[model samples]
Target: MSALDHIRKLHLPDGARILDVGGGSSVLVDALLRENTSWSITVLDISQSALDHAQTRLGSLAKRVTWVAADITQWIANDPVDLWHDRALLHFLADASDRATYANTLRTALKPGGIALIASFSLNGPEKCSNLPVHRYDAQGMLATLGSGIILKDHWLMHHHTPSDKVQEFQFCLFQRV
Candidate 1:
């Protein structure tokens, strides 16, 4: 199972609201739905086409997911989520100001004591992905960037084999809002 799948299996409060940051076309929502349909799952992405594609792929199950098309740095969340998950999205925030905005937005969107599950390109990984520049990080970097309010719970590195058979290293960090 992927890091995301593993995180989803962890014991969380029943009926926790989950926000999949930059969820886009990822299948993580589908897995979450299968694991616990009772939990409210929302997918926030900047691309409408990505949301549309995910909705198409989900078919009847799509109705259960709340999809939002907006940039995370400035988007106002309609729900106070208990869990926030981001994969590679933080790396895309190349500008320091943008990263700060993202951090502020994260703090504003999630309720304290909530779970934050983030995956990012490791320091040794490619400097660019999907034709865009990326910022590499280790667990310490992520923790520092996220600020002291983040209480580290777990951290690890994983090698992901993409659809094109390329290997990309990623650092996964799990934190609880303190």
Candidate 2:
């Protein structure tokens, strides 16, 4: 997606460790491998089914990725990563406590100056997805919610049409650890 174009512009070091939190079956992993196979990429998800699906989809290239089956709020990485990307997970943290844990985990997982690319439902987007309530935010609201230590590097909004023919607004924010 356009987000990756911006990420690619970062010109991260070769063999940089990247973590895709709550990324389950996203073609980003595939595209990333195609772009640079040297980067160590880890894809984490709470669902075994999703991971399995991704593994199946990736086929032989699946070995190139580290697949972790765990909840982001409860999971901790053994080592820090240079870049973190999340596309499908944050909106589900409707509970304040859950958001705090997620934010804390994010802060802990990154190396200093590391990059985080997060996407979520915008304030003007849907209030819920799959019948679960979502917490929505504009760029400033998201920056406020994340609080300290995260510097807002860039942000933008994009419109997505679902398979069911529904319009959903997505806010993409890029942050760097200070």
Candidate 3:
């Protein structure tokens, strides 16, 4: 299973409000729906088409998810969330300032004791995706960038084999807002 799938397996509180940051067309949203029916998810992404695709794929379950189309770096959330989950999103913000803004947004949106699961390209992974350069991060590096309000829980390395059998390395960091 992927890092996001593994994180979902870790027992979460019932009726938790989850924010899938930069979720787009990722399968995580659909997986979450099939795995748990009570949890409410908010899928936030900059791409309207991506959200549309996800919504179409979800069918009836799509109604349970709130779709927000906005650049996370500049967008401010109106309410706090019980969980913040992002995969392959933070690395897209190659600039320090951009990363800082994303981190700040997470800090502001996560409630006390809320959980955060972030996955980024590892140092060993490909440097770019879709021809765009990505910022690789280790657990300590992610913690340093995200700051002290969120406590690091665990760090896991994920090796994903592409359809062509090429392996991509990813690092997942779990945190809890204090």
Candidate 4:
């Protein structure tokens, strides 16, 4: 299933806080807005231009979302969220220290028992993207990198068809903070 499909299956409670890490200009926010008006959603990305594009596309609905332009490794969560969704972001952290920081950030951003839906390049996927090398992972590798207090709920493999007509393998994992 697609990441959005998995999120929809979650059936999160009304008014739940959601953090879309590196969501940027993704249409996920648009879909989420249509799904539930009561949800408090935040889209965090390092690109201000991308966020602006999303805001323009969203128009009035943009006001409903909190847009944060900061690197996940350095960004601090003022409040914990019920759900954390990341797509094609984790694999970009090639440095071990960066990966550790990402894990810590995830822990700090998610409330106890909250859900995290992380999608990344699979072991068999491209070695690099956008001319930058990526750290690929399978479900087990992801779990190991995330460290303790997070338990895996489910995982699956998917093939993403890029705009350039290239197929990229990805692994999607669902976990719960303890």
Badly placed stretches (over 4 Å) of model 1 are none
Q: Write the per-residue lDDT of candidate 3 for residues 1-178, one digit (tens) a residue.
A: 6745665676877788899988987988887887778888899999999999999988988898999999999999778988899988999999999989998999998999988999999989899976899999999999998987989999988898879898989999999899
Q: Sort all candidates by lDDT, best to worst.
A: 4, 3, 2, 1
Whole-model lDDT per candidate: 0.86, 0.87, 0.88, 0.93
Clashes per prediction?
0, 0, 0, 0
| Residue 170 Cα positional deviation in candidate 2, in Å, after optimal superposition | 0.8
Q: Cα lDDT for residue 108, model 4?
A: 89
Cα lDDT tens digits for candidate 2, 1-178: 5656876988989999999988786878887888887999999999889889989999999999999999888997678999989885889998888888888888889999999988999989999987999998788887777779999999999899999989999998999999
The residue-by-residue lDDT of candidate 4 on 1-178, one tens digit each, is 5556788899999999999998996999998998899999999998999999999999999999999999999998888999999998899999999999999999988999999999999999999977899999999999999999999999999999999899999999999999
Evaluate residue 115 in candidate 2 and report its C-alpha lDDT on the 0 to 100 scale: 93
Instruction: Please tell me which predicted candidate would have the highest TM-score against the true structure.
Output: 4
For candidate 4, list the clashing residue pairs, or say none: none
**Model 4: lDDT to the true structure:** 0.93
Error of 2 at 169 (Å): 0.7
For model 3, name the residue pairs that clash. none
Query: lDDT of model 1 at residue 158?
Result: 90
In terms of lDDT, the poorest run of 10 residues in model 3 is 1-10
Q: Considering TM-score, which of the candidate structures 3 and 4 is the better prediction for this target?
A: 4
Give the TM-scores of the predictions, in the order they appear.
Answer: 0.94, 0.95, 0.94, 0.97
